[model samples]
Structures are given as structure tokens and as C-alpha cells.
Target: MGFFDNLLLNLDASVTGLFGQWNIWTSLLATALVGFLTYQVATRQDPDTHPFLLARQAQGTAVRQPGESPVYRSQAAPHGMLLNAGLNVKDPGASKWSRGRDGDLRDVWRQAVAGVQEPGPTKGAKGRILTVLGAEKIVEHNLDDITRQINLIGQHIADQGGNRVAIYLPNSVELLATLFACAFYNLTAVILPFDQPDDAVISMLRRSATDTVVTAPGSFPFDAVVKNYPSLRQLIWVVDEGSKHMDWNEVPQGTGGSVNVSTWQDIVNDAPLDAGKTLPPLEGQKEPRDVTVFWQSKPGQQEEMVRFTAGNFVSAIAAQIFAIPTSQRMGPSDLFLPADSLANSHTLVLTLAALFSNASVAFNSVASQADDLATATGGIAPTILVATPAALLKLHTESKPALSSFIGSKLHWLQTRSLTQKGMMPAAGGLLSSYYDRTVRPALGTTTTTTTPNKKKLRLIVTAERVGADTPKLSSAVLSDLRALTGARIMYALTAAKVAGAVTQTNFYDYRVFDDKCSHFGPPLTSTEVLFRDTEQYKTSDNISQGEIIVRGPCVAGMEAALGVAGKMREDNTLAYV
Candidate 1:
């Protein structure tokens, strides 16, 4: 065999060993590529036949069903318990944009800085900031430096078997760097909110089983936690050069605090600064199965760990379902003013939906009232906006003119989520009618088509808030009434919450709720399973006409095998049925 054939043989063997079932499909794709290339060579009577043109033709041939469309197998699946099907698209050159002649993320960011016109004579300092809440000087923080620091931190953590790290700090550049560092090493990062009571911090530390605690110097005087928790092996505090906690500043000879405080400069100096030298392979390939974060539900409850796989990040499932096409009408130049707490996987959805298009993400610490959001959005002239139902209601009620102006002129798409299904009933008719008649229909901008016609249209993705089944079913109900009475959106009341167990016995217009269930009220996205029980043992929908809404999927955090349990589980415990 020739060199290429021998290389292919080795590649097939390695891939097959890595992912047994997936390799068969991979081999098929490779075969398809060769066949298509051969066909192109034989049939291309003209030089103008591009690869895209050939691929389109190949797609047409592959999908022969009438009125049935060809599905890009990589399309992200819904958030559910089961593992997603189809090929994951993250191995190499994974960006949606082919990194062609234009640029990569680095190049685009640089271009964005150079392209925006500085407002005054202040040169580069005069322009608007992309991220307002992060970094000391976002404009000045070098991406290269951030990347190097990330590597150094990853190396340090990886050397210790990828133990969990708890980061405590105000929203700052160091926090951002630490996040990237943890991502580099595949270490689970628990971002304990800053300014919690010392007791709360201690509880969080113990709950997360944090091995190392990294905090902003003097932020929480959390020495008590270090003293109390046996799991905590080290504490590194980021301090100022001349602060009392500085390395040169000696502690009282008898002071018995085991915590160590160090300056940020010391960390940079001691850790390797080059990405090549510092960043190493995590413990393994770092799939979506690896826990990356811990999220707490109620204030006193232990934090639960959430893992975002490389597949999850790359798939960007939420972003895909909520993105709008980029025509001159609505594209990257558009601004996004997000209420910091309000945006999470949903905003990620918004960013990804637009083909990794760059947009300014402005953060606000204070409650972003409707007027403030509109003012910021208006000044930025963003084509897209994300708001909560409550926030949207406020805007609809408070500033009609500004709202009209946005819907009439700049705004092309609006995505809302967390609305209880009950809430939708009240807002559905009036809001939809007013929104379409007064704004959306009137704007009538030229269409920007990137794919199929419907796929290209602007859309709003609203996730109904979890609700109990105990409300009126009329579609004409007002949003205020639904929210006040049911405390959630209409759809969730009809689905997950209403049908599942409930804390209070109540029945709404269309849902059956079981009250007094502890598991009912936990945030579905953040709760984790303590033990894997038999699927058969789970209370069925027949029990009380309510079903168990078992939590699974990549999003839920805090899942771990319970230790010291009496019985060893069976092989059937491996998969989730819910």
C-alpha cells in the first residue's frame, strides 16, 4: 500500500478505538467525500464549479423526500435527558465561519476595535465598551495576555488531578481570566457570588468540596472557612502590591490562619506566561460529560455542579434555535444590551444563532429598567434585543413612544424566555396583535436570506416559566392575572410543573398538580440527581395524574455518585429514562 493508504489505515484504527459506534458513520462521511470528489472531477466540464455548488447538488441527491428537507446532521437537539444524537462538530477548525480570507474571532475583535469610530479626540479610549461589567479596562486587556494566563493557571490545576477550584470575587478581569484558566485545564469552577455572608461562603466551600479557594484579597476574611473545612487544602488571595496582605507583610507570629495571600503580580511571575508551555491536555479529551461549574439553588442549599461539554459549547444548541439571519437589516453590527442576570444559555443562543457574528454585549449592574435599556439600545441602534417578560411588560406600559420607535425602526428581532405558560395566555393576544400591527409589520425591512425561507425569518423563542396546574385555561387571560394567580407561564403549567409533583395542592384550568413534593420547586436547570434509582421505581403519571419530572441533560449541575451506600447498583442504572 502507498503512504496515503497506510495513513488512512492507522487513522481508521485510532478513531474506531476512540469512539466505536461513531467511527462507522465517520468512515461513511469520508467515503462520501471521496465519491463526491471523484464525481466532480469527471463531470465538471466548466472551471466555475465550486465545492459549494457540488455539495448542494450532493445534498439534493441525498435527500429525495418530497416536501421533506435535508437536515444538516449537526443540528442541535432539544435540551432533554438523553444524550444528543449525530456527529459532534468540534474536533478542528470548529468555527461556523470557515476562517476564510476575512478573519477568526481574534481578527474580528481587532477589526471591530479599529472599525468603530472613536467618539471624541480621546483616540481609542473614546468608543463604547463591548462588555461594561468585566475587566479593569476591557479595551486595554490584551487577548494574548489573557490567553497566556489561562494556560498558566490550567497547568497548575492539571498537575493536581484537576481538583475543583472555588473562585470568589467581584465581577472583574481576574475572574474572567480565572474562568478561562479553568476551562483550559478542564477543572470544575465554582463561581461563588461575591459579598455573601462568611457563613454562606463557608457552606458553599464545604458543599462544593473545593480543594483550593482563590479569592480577591481581603474580600471576605474567609479564614474561618479555611480553618473549618478539611477539604480545603490551599487558599490564594489576589492582593495589591502595598497591601497588608502582601507577601512581604508578615503575619503576627502567633496568628494561626492557614490561608495564604498572594498578589496577582506574583501569580503572573511564578506561572508560565506562554500558552505553548502552560496549557496541557486536561485529564482527557474533555467532553461535555465533564462537570465544569457548580450552581446553587436557594441561598442556604449546597451548590450543585454543572458540566458543559466541549460538544455543548461547540453545538451551541440554544443559540442556534434563537438566532436571526444577518442581512444589512440585522447582523453583527447590531448591539445587544442584556440584563446581566437575565442572560445565560438564552443569550448564548442569541449569539450562536447569528453565525458567530460579533455584537456588543453591554452589562449593567443595576436593575436595567425599560427606559435605561431602550436608551442604551437606541444609542447603540441594536437590531436585536433580549428582555424578560416582566421587563417587556414594563417597557410596553411605561414608554410607549420609545418602544414604538424601537419596534418601528431598529429592532428586527426580540427573544424572550422564562415566561410561565400561564403568562403567555394573557400576553398572547394583545401583545402579539399590538407588536405585529404597530411595530413588526410596519418596519418591513428587506429580507436577509442565509438558508431556507422560513429559517431566515426573525423569530422569538420564549421558554414558559415552570408553573403548577391550577389556573384558568382561557386564552384571553391577562398576563398580570396569570402571573399573580398562577405564578408562572401558561405552557409550563400545562406541561412540566402542572403535571409533575407540586408543593401545594392546586389545580388550574388545564394542569393537574401534586402538592407537597420537595423536588417540585428546585430549578430544573440547576438541580442534580443524588442517586440513580430504577426507572421503574419512579412514580408514574398514573399515581395522581402527575408524573415525575426527572432532571437530566447537560445543563443540570451537582450530579455525582453517592458514596458509602449499601447496595452496589446494576448495569441498568447507567442510562436515564426521563
Candidate 2:
């Protein structure tokens, strides 16, 4: 007591001496000065934190600041702008997606890749670019390497008279290179889903009129499948080593030896670096790289080939970029993991979105089950995840409860809800992350039922493509449980089987307003235009609530994604599922 009292007496004396001479007004003024200086430093260092992003900072809409992230928050009364609150469709001539080079996906992709060339952080190959998974070692591809491969592969297609090339392999860096090569050479890429049965694949091959099939070294019974379809003139095996691949001599004989087997290495390695020189310039074509992605209307039914043009791809990338909050925007430093098969529209587009923004992409198995989801999340620990509602639901149901129902309710209202109403402090980003600084790891034998900790926490990129919005269980509400488990901010979308890509997506920052109970697929993407007509999609008797939804934009259907899909629209400009 004697020692503690002496210490306290000394501390009080020091505090009194320091502030006693300063009046209350002076102390308050000094505090304000310090706070102002702190804010100034933070904004200057991180431009995204500045209040006006869609306004003044949008000066270079496509450009990202070096070192600092583009995602930001509001200092006072903070909220994101209604990117499409009102359909600014007064002038049909004013469509930005249709303005340049027809706003083709090819051009947009080119621009997005170019944007990354700036002196800053990046991921991928050759020069710390994209990273490919499934290899015994790490593989990266730079823009130059990708371009070279594209030109050579494009040249190969031109020489083979192969107008349509089908890729039937798991996610890898080579698949991306091939798709870009198709875009580069003005050839149509036919992508076959990797998960389909051999019979389904063979049927789709014949139906697609595919001349060549690209696949991994040991993927399926390539010989048996291709034998059924004589139109499949070639089977190109993907091998990291040219010498190790089964040579043409070892390949199975197709009908009349019409099928020529080659390795991806042989095609690219043998071509000259100046292969693109002889190819026709993209400007000369009336239409550019057309892609045919097969969608099975049902599991056992015949596949429908939905064609997408470069322009549609471009619009998709641009609109997707606009949809991501600057705070959550994909950057060069962030690693992207496409857990779902790249065959899915959402997965492919998001991959391109990351590359277009100079971010890195990693591969993981198609997350169709809870185990797969857990493995993918834990293996990659991705910051951005592109998955379907089914996978998300699986993870939610499989997860060990962090809080009991009653305690969860208490935290939801008392903690998560309150902080969300007041914008998330940039400093609080870690609070939702596994690296949360405030909480200490509990020792063994401790039973902290209220705290559910995820060592690999990640945000979500989900789609409502096949979901029935009116169905309570399968609707966006399914993701509510998942969000609470991982503190992941989900950006859900209204994607359709027939649609070229995303029709509507939630604003990343706007998740808090509409919590976990109901489905909230945000407004239409910037490049898409939507309108509704009376249809069965309108479950509600209210005249304004339901109707068949129609969209016209670069991300629509048709070769250039200039076509539209049928759906229902709400009065608030959101798309209702058909």
C-alpha cells in the first residue's frame, strides 16, 4: 500500500503539472489540430479513404493509385453511390459500353491487362505475373509470355483451318493462355465443362462442331471420346515438358487418321516469336474472337452453346470492376482463387476481372461440396472467392457453430449491426480477419462458445444464376449463415443459364443495410440495361413487383453479348429471377 500510494501520488502530480497551466479551450483546440493532421496524413497516403471516389477521384476511372489501394470509405455519413440508382438511359447514343471499338470484350481485356503494366504490384508469370496451381512447382506467366503463346496458338489454329477449338481440362494457367490466344487469333473457343461425363462430353463435342480439343495430359479417355466424333480432328495434350508428352506417333488413330494429336508445348515452342505479324489485324474483322460456352439446360438434356463476343466480355470486366468497392477491389497484391470450375460464367469472368486489374489468380478444385469448399478456402486462403450458393450453403451447414442461436442474435444486433451502420473503419479491416489484433487465441480446454474463429477468413463472390429467389431456403438467405461464420462480405449476383454474364450484382459496401434474412441481388451492372414485362417470374400479385426481365447491353447474349436474356425486374431496377 505504501509503494502503490507513492506511485499514484507521483503520477497525479505529473499529470496536473502538464495540463494545469492549459485552459480547457486550449486543450480542446490542440486535440482538434492533432486529429486534423492525422486525417490528412491518412488520406494522402491512401486516396481511397477520401470521401469522393465516384466523383473527383474518378478522374482516371480506369487507373489505380500506385502502392495505395483503390477501395475507400467515407469519413462522415459514409455510404457508396447508387451506381445504377437511375437508369441513365435518356440517350441510347450515350451507351459507354458501345462507344469505343464497339466496347468489345477483346478491347476491354486488352485495356485491363495494359492497366497492370504500370509500375506497381502485380501477379502472374514470367515477371511475377499470374500463378498457376496443380503443378509440382510454382508457375507464373507474364503479359509478354501470354502474348507469345496466344500468337503462336492462334497461328496454329489458322494453319489447321480450325475455326473452333474446344478446351476440356481443369483450371490451369495454360487454359487462360489458350482462351486469350483464341481472342488474339480471332478464333472461337469452345469450352467443355471438365465435370461432364465422357458420354456428355462426346455429345457436346459433336454438337459444337469442334475441330480440336485441348486437354491435360491424362484427362479422361481422350482417345475413346474423340473416336466417336470425326469432326474432332485433333487432340492436343497439355504437358509442361515437350519431351514427356505422348508424341503424335503414340496418339490413337482417329477415323481415317483425320485426328492429329499434339502437345501444347510442341505448338507454342515450334512457332516463331513474330507469328502474330502475318495474322490479320483485329481492326480488319467485322467481328472478333467469339467464344462458345456450353450450358446444360438440365443434367441429362442436350447442351446449349451460348456464344459470347469480345465486346460482351469487355463490358463484363468493366462493369464488374465498377461493382467492386474500392476497399474490396482486386489488386495486384491480392491472390484470387477460382474454386469453382472455370467453366462457370462467374468464375471465368472474375478471373479475367482480376487479371484485367493486375491481380494474381490461383487454382483450386471445383468446390461442389462442403469438403471441397473447406479445402479450397484453407488451401488457398484467397481474399476473393467466386462460388455458387450451393457451395456456400454447404460450408455454412458443415461449419462448427461459433455462437449459439441466442448469443449470435445478441452479437448480430449489438456488435456487427452497429458497426456496419457506422461505416467500417479502415483500421477495423483486420477485426473481421483471422489476424484480428484485439482478440487473443484461447488456450486449450477453454470453451468460448460465443467466438467462432476462422484461420482462413475470406469474402465471397456468389451468383444467383439457378436460384429461385422466392424460395426461402435457396435464396440469398442461404448465404446469411455463411457470412456470419466468416465475417465475409458477399457480393451476390443474378446470373442466368442463358445470359452471357452477370445481370445484377450487389455493391460490396452495401451489404450491411440488408442483413442476412432476405435475398438482395443488387442493381444491374453499369454496362447492362434492364426492363421488365409481365411474366410468370412475378410471383407477387402486385403489378409492379414482377415481370419478365429483359436486358440489352454489351454483356448480353449473342456473339458480342449484344443479345438479351428473359427475366423479371423490380420497381427498384433490380432483376427478379425467372
Candidate 3:
């Protein structure tokens, strides 16, 4: 009818005659082919190491010397397009089922940082990879700093003759240093939930027989928790953001037992740099190091101590990294924010997951407050946001008041549909998105534009352990709500005690598949197999599914205990909760 319409018709006719019809089915087939090729490229792996490739290089080149290693431009190895990490050689000690890095967790870090050094205080140093949010200064801890602190901490705890140490601090840079230190040595690290009251902390400490407590100043019931646990003989305190300090001697000593208190600052100041020098003499003892124990409690039951071996830990980290989309892997370039308590399974696992991929992790302490987790995350947008459903629910509740009126939004949606059909604008930059984001979004307090080149897109990774039958954090509602508000992809995860990591996670691209209130957790992670067993105990866990989810895999603990979770596998290879 118009000049442009006539021109478009002519072009379409020419294209059809020259090539082929661009129908819906043809477009879908092209999309599938492109996706398959992209997947192959993204998941590519180099089979042969540079040394091996050079060894097989042509003999006439500069590497002509016999048995000489250095060479260039060699033929590629077979199946060199797989996504892999860590040492490629076969480990004699690694089990066929394991297929994991079989040594200390620190080894994983070594692999992650190899040849990826950044220039800093030390020449080409891998400096301070952690960021503690809400701190007065930019807090960061590098591998060397972490190692030095570990040496000092290992000796201090060893002096007290205690191997099991409980960390009862909020998400901080110090927490990361301490956990890795305990794992490097053979000490068992117990992550105590910082939000618990004194009674719960003391009860869990006594149950775990934790002999050492590491926490920051003025943490919840610090004096009360350490005093009640008689097995705990030492209290290692760390410094807060400000110069504010506390004296352990000033507080009343607990009559329950005689406990010696020390500060992390004092220990680092007093201990020598070579604290781990003596470690070489005791290296070949064949003792299983890095035993990390996570405590999960039921309302009327004793706290469950889930023990994770180094193999289990490595497997869990690997599975978490692979569970992410190949394009959105939490790699070295990403900044991950853990808004929930690091003690929670999801936060803790994803924190280390980011680390294993050489990505820096950022911690938000405001989220640990009584309320305002989502509010605290107002301006700060990290590439990956790992949060609990409770935190996301708080955000959702706070965002509801900021949404546009019902009728106005309906009109805007209709307008967007028509405009998109006319090819005038992108769906993302439609009238509704621009209007609500500009007018109502000031409530969120984000000043920068979402399209800024430097600003990373947000990917919300939610764990539902905090959302129960009585909780307000409905999975389906929270997922859809937060996605609509922030335009971010939300991936949900389910934690099982026996499973070292999340048993299942929603696919990276799958969003809001269920209109019903109940939401699905997607599918089991790689190297994991899951089946449903009929059980009434976990029936209350979900409404649409009734069974105890049984998972046995490389990262799964050997146990048959009912995890009190109900789920079913879908034909699309995802798990949906009723």
C-alpha cells in the first residue's frame, strides 16, 4: 500500500527466488543449527598440552634439539573442543567415578590462577580476589595473604589441640581466608549460621564438638556461644571494618569451662611468615585433610552434620560451574555477589563455585540484617547474584509498591505488542519497560543506566532452603516477580544434606515455566542421577509432587535418609516441585 511496503515485497520476492522461503519452521531449524554449533564452540577443550603438542611438532623447526621441550605451531589434538579445567593428566589416586581433582581445595585455586596473573602490589601478582561490601575501605585478599593468614591460624588452633573450628561470622573477606586455611590443613571447618540466636549456636557447636570458634567482634552472642561449648577451648576474633577493637580479657570468662581467647589481628602480628614451613615435615601422613562439615537442622530434630570430603567438594564445585550456561559461566571476568549468609548451603557453594572459576566474589553484609536484603541490593548489581528465597522475597515485597497501576501496565503491554509487531522497537526497550523503569524504579535507588557498557547484567541464582511451607517466599511468585522487576534470569536450586552441592538447579535459560504457585528446580546437575521414592515424610515439602528425592552421584553423600523434599522429573529433563 505504501512505498516502503512495495519495496519490502520486491526484496522478499527476490530473496525467495535467489535462496529459499524463510518460514517459521526454516527459521527454527536455522536457530537449532546455530545453537548446536555455538554449544560445540563454547564447550571446546584442548586435548593435548602445549608441551605434548610441541613434543610432536615437526622436527625441522627451531625445536630440533633432542628431548627439548619448547616448540611452536603444532597440530591440534583429538577431541580438543571440550570444556575442561584442572590438571589433564590421569591421577593414580583418583577413582573412575570421581574424575575430579583429588587433592586439597587449594589445588583448585592453583589451577584457576595459573598463567592468569594480574599486575598489582607484587609483580604479576594474583592479588586480593575477594571484595567485602559495606566496608569502609575496599577489602581484598589474595592467595599469598590468604596463605599467610592460614599459616598463622593453623598454628593457633593447633596450639589449642583443636581440629574442628566453627566460623560464626557474616559474609566477609576474612571468612573466605579462614575456610580455605582450615581445608589446607586437616582441620574440620564448621560453618555456623551467623543469624542464629545464642541458644541455637551453642546447641549446634556442642553437637559438632567444635573446639575452636572464629568470629568477628560484636557478632551475635559471641561470648555466650563460645562459653557454653566446653569442647571449645579457643576463640579467634577478627577485626571489623572500622578501627574499632575489643579486648577479650575485659569480658567475663565463662564458668562453664576455661577458654582462651585470641584475636586474628594479634595472631597475624605475632606469628612468623614461615608458620607453614613445618608443614613439609608432616606432609606425607596420609591423613584426609579439608573435611568441611555443614550443619542442617529440622524444627524438632537434632542438627544434621553433613560431612564433605575433598573429592566431594571438588565434584560439587565442578558440577556447579557446569550447571551454568556455557555463555554465562561464572568465569574470571565476572563479579559474583552473595547476598545471603555465607553459612547457607547455596551461598557458600556458589561463593566457592565462583572462586574455582577464578571469578572474584563480592559480599553484601546489609542483607544479613533483620530486614532489607533486597533493599540493600538497590544500586549494587554484580554479574551473578546468589541469594536465598527469603532475601529475594524481601526484595519482591519491597518492589510490589513500586510497580505501575494495573490498568496502566495492561495498556503499556498492549502498546508494546503492537509496536513490536510493527518492527518499530525492541521488546526490551518497549514503553512499559522504559516507563516503569524511569518513573517507579527510583524506589530501587539505582542511578546508572542499565545499558551502560561497564555495568554487568544481573543473573539471580536463588536457593529455596529458606522458603518453607510457612514462609512467604513462594518460589513461582518470587521468580516471576523479581525477573519482571529487574529483567534478570532467575535460576532456582534445591539443597539436599547428603548431596555436597545442589541436587538440582533450574536450567539457565528456562524461566517461569509454571503459571501455578509451585515452581520447579529444573534438573539434576551434571554427573548426578536423581529418582523419586514414594514417602509421606517429604509429601508436605511440595504440593504438586509427593516423594523423597533420591540422588546418587559423584558429589552425593552415601545415605538413604529422607531429605524431606518432593519433586518429579519432567519429559524436558527438568525437575518440577508440586
**Top candidate (lDDT):** 3
Ranked by TM-score, top first = 3, 2, 1
Q: What would the per-residue lDDT of candidate 1 be over residues 1-578, giving only the tens digit for each residue?
A: 99999999999999977786667788999899999999767633422123222121111113322222211111112223332311222223455543222111222223323332223333332112233322221232444464565666556555655477787765344555565566555576666656667777887777777787667665665546645776665555666445734463244454425434344555667664443343343235353223234333344555444444433433333222222222222233444444322213333333332323333333333323232334323322223444434443443344335435754323212212112221122223345445544443312112232211121212221222222212212221233222322222221211121111111111111121222211121111111221222233332221111122333332222222221111111121111112
Scored by CA lDDT, what does every candidate get? 0.36, 0.55, 0.57
Error of 1 at 1 (Å): 99
* Candidate 3 stretches greater than 4 Å from native: 1-104, 111-137, 220-227, 241-246, 249-257, 273-287, 290-302, 369-371, 406-436, 440-454, 465-478, 536-546, 559-561
lDDT of 2 by residue, 192-246 (tens): 8886777888888888788877887655567667567767776677774544644
Worst 10 residues of 2 by lDDT: 68-77
Reference-based TM-score, model 1: 0.46
Q: Which candidate is the best by TM-score?
A: 3
RMSD values for the candidates in order, in angstroms, are 23.0, 12.3, 13.8
Give the per-residue Cα lDDT of candidate 3 at 401: 53
Quickly count the clashes in candidate 1. 23
Error of 3 at 95 (Å): 19
Whole-model lDDT, model 2? 0.55
